[model samples]
Target: MKILTITGYKGGCGKSVTAIHVATYLSALGDVVLVDSDPNRTSLSWANRGQLPFTVVDERKAMKVVQGRDFIVIDTPARPDSSDLKELAEGCDLLILPTLPDIVSLEPMLQTAHDLGEANYRALLTIVPPKPSREGEAMREELRSNGVPVFSTMIRRTAGFQKAALAGFPIRDLTGRDRMGWLDYDSLGSEILEAIGR
Candidate 1:
């Protein structure tokens, strides 16, 4: 079993969105379970409303459930400094930190990845914008220099995601994709799996 944890230092960085998509896409290859470690239970609520394919557990009860699962995809809270976040991250095979291309978002992501390394956790970047601004490309180059393994595929900004969130559903279940978000996510999932050596 391979445990993949989706985490970030702040909200609106696409933590839950990436977790749900990765879990759904990974399940196509093997059995998978979604674990909600966010206090808000955002992933759980969406799963309940949409009746998604996998199961979601309460934050406090996740560890016990993790011990028994073949694959656990955790949606972690944005607070990277928390002891619980460290514990959850330590238990995983891979840690995924998603952030927008903005410098405000990028700085914390860099710091968190550093902290994860200090705690002996392996992490990678996600949710990078497709049409990056000048500063965004600069941030990517900076991350590369810092030795962070960024995915070649990025989750572009899109209204399809907003519609799916509003409807409490996954993008794969949504319609009218002028651009296919799942393709990006699937490619991302494959990269993450390979990175984890799973």
Candidate 2:
């Protein structure tokens, strides 16, 4: 199974959201289980509030739930220490680091990449302002120049995401423009699959 872990040093960077959506995208290929490794239980709470295509279990219960799973998406706790981050990187097939486009968020992300050393990982820019704002692209280019492995697919910030979380549905499962956010993840999912050569 391809195990994917979503982690970040900062909170509110859409780590849990990205984890859920990615798991939803992977479900198309095979059975997927999302392990809520985060102490906050964000993924587990969302699953309890509504229906999810895949299973979501707390880390404590993950061993049993992970059996026969084709994909395992882990939503790790925010602010893991350097040593913990290194361990997390070595343990997962691909480490996904989601961060905002702003400088405050970038520092931790860059540090995370550094702490990961040679581990397989990619940076995903989340909550990117749409249209007139060029922050997302600008930051992406900057990261590339700095030798950071960032995804070309940037996730635009939208209220649709919050709605999805509140309703316990994947962004793709929503109706109308609210579901538009799914497009970003669809592209991201494609990139992730290719990154891992799956």
Candidate 3:
């Protein structure tokens, strides 16, 4: 099974949101389990509320419990130090660091990447404003320039994500205008599958 850890040094950076969306999209391929490692238990709470299709479990059994699954998406806590980052990334196929379009988030992302040594990791831009602005593009350029692999697909800022989280459903499960939030995550899931040759 391939393990994907979604993490960031800062909270409110869309780590859990990205984890839920990616896990939901990947379920189409095979059995996908989400491991909520964060103390906040955001993913687990969402599962309990919505009765999501995939299984949600705590971190204690994450590694062992994922034995037969196709993908194990781990939603980590905020502000893990360099050593903590290394420990969390152990046996991970891909480490995704979700960050907003600002330096406050980017700095820690870069540091975490550096701490991971040669591990396979990518920085994903999330909570990006939909309005046309150079901020998103500039952040991408900065990460690339700093030798950080950034996902081309950026998760745009939308009330849909918050609403979906509150209602205990994936953005894809939402209807009407709120459903538009699925597009970016779909693209991201595809990109990730391609990257890992899944």
Best by lDDT: 2
Q: Write down the lDDT that model 2 would get.
A: 0.92
lDDT of 1 by residue, 1-198 (tens): 888888877888788989998888887777678988788888888877766666678767766666655678988878768566677667878777777777676677667666655553433344555563454566667777877666666776677777776677778887667237877787887887777776
Runs in model 1 deviating more than 4 A are 61-68, 82-86, 118-136
My TM-score estimates for the predictions, one after another, are 0.85, 0.98, 0.94
- lDDT per residue for candidate 2 within 6-25, as digits (tens), equals 99888899999999999999
Q: Using lDDT as the measure, name the better of candidate 2 and candidate 3.
A: 2
lDDT of each: 0.73, 0.92, 0.88
Clashes of each: 0, 0, 0
lDDT for 133 in candidate 3 is 73
What is the Cα-based lDDT of residue 61 in candidate 3? 78
Model 1 clashing residue pairs (backbone): none
RMSD of 2: 0.8
Misplaced by over 4 Å in model 3 are 61-64
Q: What lDDT would candidate 3 get against the real structure?
A: 0.88
TM-score: the better of candidates 2 and 3: 2
